[model samples]
Target chain A: MRSHRFYTPWLLMLPALVWLALFSVWPAINTITLSFTNVHQLTGGHYIGFKNYWLLWHDPHIRDAVLNTIVFMVICVPLLTFLPLLLALLVQRNIRGIAFFRTAFYFPVIASAVTVALIWKWMLDDRGLFNNLLQTMGFVHKTVPFLTDRWLLLLSAIALTVWKGLGYYMLLYMSALGSVRRDLHEAAAVDGAGTVRRFWSITVPGVRGTMILISVLIAVNAMRVFSELYILGGATGGVGGQDVSIVMLVQQAASGSDGRLGYASAISVFLFFLTAIPLLFLTRLNKNNQEES
Target chain B: MTATTAEDSREGRKRRVRGTGAVRHPDRKGRSPIFDAPTPHGLFFRYLALIIVLLISIGPMLWELSTSLKSKAEDVYTQNIQLLPHHPTLGNYGEVQNTIPVWHFALNSLTVAVINVTGNVIGATLAGYVLARLKFKGRKLLLGVFVATLILPAEVTIISKFQMITSMGLGNSILGVCLPDMIAMTNVLLMRNAFMALPREVEEAAIIDGANVLQRMRYVGLPSVKGVLSVISIFAFIGAWDDFLWPLLVLQSPDKLTLTVGLSYLNGQWSHDPRTIAAGTMMALLPILALFLILQRYFFRGVAQGAIKG
Candidate 1:
């Protein structure tokens, strides 16, 4: 009777396990196999082995994409890491109206990113509110093209990324913050530690696990940035204004009327490797940390 | 008889310790003159910082609200600087409805989102329970795979997944969107965590009562994880509704589009029409806003608990 009971679970699980294998594993294998072929025009393909990858070295767009993605990550990751924790700390206080402010912060998390990029599209125009504010404040004599300027384009997108993303990260940190023992802080204060010192010594170490989690999340999300660039229309070589992110590069490659699936597949394969490296390290780190705890 | 003096001394020490800053932290600085009461400066500064964080976080959304009311020309010129519309009109909403079948897209979005939510709720709960309570083979490996998948960006599997959909003839259909999302990894992990926290004695009692696996789960486990299940429902809803990439890949037909993809079409047409675009954006936002407001109590609490458990 117990044996029969045990068998029922395996029977129930078969469908879900099959679904996972079909959607996730099989498709992943296909992506790997497809990357090895000269699948440029889609109809017929020869398995060209490493030829496609070798050719990638000559592709300037891929290089630019790699550079652009790195630049975006370098500029965005640290700020994204610390800013949310700071915001979470600020709001974790038992202050009046904190709940209202927290809700306000969460609005963008529920809003569509496509819509966010579009709304910002209008706001970042040459005569948009951003420039108008600067001009009104007498900060600049001429309107600054924050969106279109070659130098400022990535920065503009970074601002959007941080704005849209902070609340979600803040929530993650807030949860971690809530779990810290109150007595620990009291003990630190009694030991003559100041606010900043206690925060660095106590709060930072307490939230190290969350820091790792957010790092992995930010790194992965950085590599997959698309909707914002798509809304920007990618001509600017920045975000919506003029700069291009790597995801835009992939979208163009994949969906181009020219049907450069081989090229696109190659690009996707490269990204797969690029993303896999960080993921590998982070997962291992997570495992080791789990074991330690 | 000798115990009276010792008891009195202990009470005096307790009073002194309680009177210290350990019980209630006092701000070293004096209270605000404007408020005319002694509120800690630390608390005041924290509130101020949070307000700024809130503004930066939600400024664009509030901007969207005001921008939708302005005329197209005004958006081009003023952006979001103008607080109230100089001339507020419902013409944009009219344009959105007329230009595209907004209600149709909403219905499609709602259908897919609800179905996906139901599927996730059932699938994740079962899987979570099995992983948590059942001593089974391959459980640890499966859990590891799910965690790994959380870090595997969709772009990695996007093309192949698209191919799978096309091959299965699920492309351009709502089922395509719902099916892939139904078996989400994060929800599984969340459910596992929630199920792990369930008291062990309840299940043991059910076992002793000769309950079958299904009966035991229904009678003992499901009741305890109600909070986690609600969180899963909301997470599934938000993910399905706000999802653009997968829908864009699978559903090409404008008529069969979800709200996110449908809004993209309106946006493409009205790239210059601020009111039309904002109206469409607002329409996309309303259902989610409604869900959040209606479930605000459950939503935040679920978020608070879910983050810790997951």
Candidate 2:
């Protein structure tokens, strides 16, 4: 009976464990091993110790991708992280028709990234609605190249990301804001605290943990942003592949005409660390913040 | 001095009323204010902010809808931006159908998404039940392993997964596309959280009634977590439906393509025609949007639950 009891749980877990091992764990281990080799998709290659890493270190295109990704992350993190807080605050009211506003804000998050990117691409095209509006409003005489120009391409991608992601992050904050005791704000208000003062002192501190979570989520997403760039940048990354992200670089290296699987694995490994390190740092920072508070 | 004392007492009464959570009379109107209730000026600004946000959020999608409906002769290029089409027609949708095998892709997507949702809900629920209700050694470690995979991005493992699927002869098949994603860690965790939240005595009663583990799971465990199951189903469906990269990587044939990958291909093929692309995009978006509209409350609740527990 004891033995049966002991084994039953494992029996229940068997299918999931098998699935995880075959897919996640094995692939993770293979990814690490493949990163050390010079394997191509068609031709099997021998173990090349750190050669891919060395090439990655010296590769200009990889450098450009890394720089662009960082720039994109830097621009997006603050905008997405803080802007949603304001949105959440605005929508977190009990006023009439607030549900409509909340639903409207959350609308973009339901669409696929491909759909979102396609819509934005049409809007930002030289002859698209945005440029037409600009020209109509006399903002610019000539059509602006939103996706063709180098920096503007990056900016356009960032805008699409922020636009799509805003509602998701806002929803997170809204949930967090919901939990914050109403009386705390009321008490603070009665103590002669102004709107900004109460927001900083009470609301900010109240949702600090969620703020950390949102930032980490945004950071991870910012690093993994590929479909937007892929669709918007015409698959090769717009204008000299200047707007290519790290994941995009990995995809290009792995599946591009060259099909450098080993090199792509190395870039994937690089991306893994790049993502993991900041996540670790953020969690630790959050821990410290908690302790301090 | 009398007037000042009367005002102080009135303020105290207002605070007490708010503290007690009493509903004010309708005639009181805006006499007493809570922290969230903005003043008239603040209300003006709040509506202003909300309108701007609503526009920014849904404006592009509405624009896509408008563009999709516009007649080909309208010339979106040189024409001033029109919120509504001058001569609205479903002509672009027809063009999309003639241009690409859209229904074929939609059916493929539906197949993959349904299989994924069903597989995930069942698999995750059983695993979550075991983890939540059954006491076993190393269960904590097992749960830890499942949770750890959440952080490992799909990019890290795509190469090997692709290799494995191809070697297994599952490539270009819908099952191949759904295989890797059959058991999502998020769904498992969500289920675990859901099962954990249920009352323990209910399961104990089932066990005491001579019901077996499977019986208890079927009768007691599954019914209680229907909300979580629905959430899991919705998420799994959405994830599978919107999936581009894995489908893009796995399925190469046009006939086997999911809607997202097919639409992406269509976007490239029809780059010169914005209306056709918009129509295709809109078509791809409509089903998910309808699902979302019907299940908006559940969707928002699931997101909130994920944010909190996850």
Q: How do all models score by TM-score?
A: 0.88, 0.92
**Which candidate tops lDDT?**
2
Candidate 1: C-alpha RMSD to true structure equals 6.7
Question: Candidate 1 DockQ category?
Answer: acceptable
Candidate 2 C-alpha lDDT tens digits along B1-310: 9996697569667766664554242224332344344556778988988888888888899999999999988877874557888999999999999999999999999999999988897789888988888988888898899888887998888877877887799977899999999987777788888889879788777777788888888888887777677778887888888988888878878889999999888987745699999999999998998888888777666565552323
Cα error, candidate 1, residue B29 (Å): 26
Instruction: Please list the Cα RMSD from the true structure of every candidate, rounded to 1 decimal place.
Output: 6.7, 3.9
Once fitted onto the true fold, the runs of candidate 1 whose alpha carbons sit more than 4 angstroms away are: A1-4, A40-44, A234-242, A256-258, A283-293, B1-38, B71-81, B268-271, B307-310
- DockQ of model 1 vs. true complex: 0.47
Error of 1 at A61 (Å): 1.5
**Candidate-wise lDDT, in order:** 0.73, 0.83
The DockQ values of the predictions, listed in order, are: 0.47, 0.61
Q: Which 10-residue window in model 2 chain B sums to the lowest lDDT?
A: B23-32
